[model samples]
Target: MTGWLGNRVITQIGILVHDIEQVSGAYAEFFGVDKPPIAETDSPDMAKTRYRGQETAARAKLAFFDMGPLQLELIQPDSEPSTWREYLDRHGEGPHHIAFVIEGMEEKVMLLEGRGFPLQQRGEYEGGRYAYMDTLKDLKVIIELLENDKR
Candidate 1:
């Protein structure tokens, strides 16, 4: 996998929260760290995502905070039935999924899907695209593919 995806794994962490501000504040209070700057973005092209043969909005408020070598992302969805909203609604506030920074995310998703790894959800943010691959049969965890942010 490393050979195929040249970039080193920069971050791997599960982001959990009911509210983006609350979660980000908890990290700051617990780690005695200041919140990193945030960036706001909205693109109609990105909002029109194909999910289950239907177009859906992907509007969100995302902020990245530095925690040692790992970065914690706080995501607040602006649409119904979003991954974040689903997690919060179903499980309350908790670890959503572990993300793996990688290259060629689309290709990686295809390979994983072909290998019987069921994709629970997939979408794009301001920074990059990501997919949640169910690998419970092997490791009992969902693997996330986060492509590097080119913008």
Candidate 2:
């Protein structure tokens, strides 16, 4: 709790899926909750999308469900060249990453890189920044860091 991750809480679990509508409903039924809200990434969301540090136009459709302390995220990758797309292409639909709500995201990313996990993808949204780390090989799952806007 006192390391690079600090006291930040893990606020999300991202699942990569092929179809948002289908999976969202299924997940809702399984969880015994109403269907979650779905949102599509705009062009601006992918304006700075990067895979292995190179920018690309990777897009995604996302659904969110409030599950007690954390939000469950379902991601359906578009045709753009992105980490989600790569994940889907390489491994098909499944649990892709677990995300931590962090602060000083860049610094944490550097610390993780120093520990041998490189940044795999990054994007900035209205009130936060998110980056995915290449920890799949070592940890069996990717790690996503989210730094919400302080304001």
Candidate 3:
């Protein structure tokens, strides 16, 4: 059967972690690079976060490592109810999501929803939109779709 995500490259791999600092250090060591910069959801662009389709006060501490064309994202959910927190509660610290960049994200989301993948969390930033699909049962990892507005 075909998947709703269509033909696209997996651009990111997100890992849910308990400690961003420690995980960043470990990843930096593994990648033979200095510590990756950590970014929070406090930016004006990402002023709001959502969980399960509802606007939420949840926040996450994030660090990103650049690996050529792909990115490795480390996410630590602060004491809030969110997809990352839920993943941590259910599976502990481990691989969480694989991301794809797509155009017409809302339409893609609807298509995926029709294929049994429901939106678990979604948010927006100034330049892009991101949504996590609950695809763990089928793919063993949540699927994240990112769409950047072409400027």
Better of 2 and 3 by TM-score: 2
Cα error, residue 5 of model 3, in Å, equals 2.8
Going through the candidates in order, what is the number of backbone clashes in each? 0, 0, 0
**Order of the predicted models by TM-score, top scorer first:** 2, 3, 1
TM-score of 1: 0.73
- Candidate 3 residue-wise lDDT, 1-151, digit = tens: 3256664688999999999999999989988999988888764346566788677878788999989999999999887788998889989998999999887888998988988989898887768888999988888889999888899
Off by over 4 Å in 3: 1-3, 43-46
Which pairs in model 2 have colliding backbones? none
Give the lDDT of residue 33 in candidate 1.
79
lDDT tens string, model 1, 69-120? 8767776665555556666676666666667788788788778878887676
Report the alpha-carbon TM-score of model 3 versus the true structure.
0.92
Write out the backbone clash pairs for model 1. none
- Give candidate 1's error at residue 63 in angstroms: 2.8
lDDT of candidates 1 onward, in order: 0.65, 0.87, 0.86
Candidate that scores best on TM-score: 2
lDDT for model 1, please.
0.65
What is residue 55's positional error in candidate 2, in angstroms?
1.3
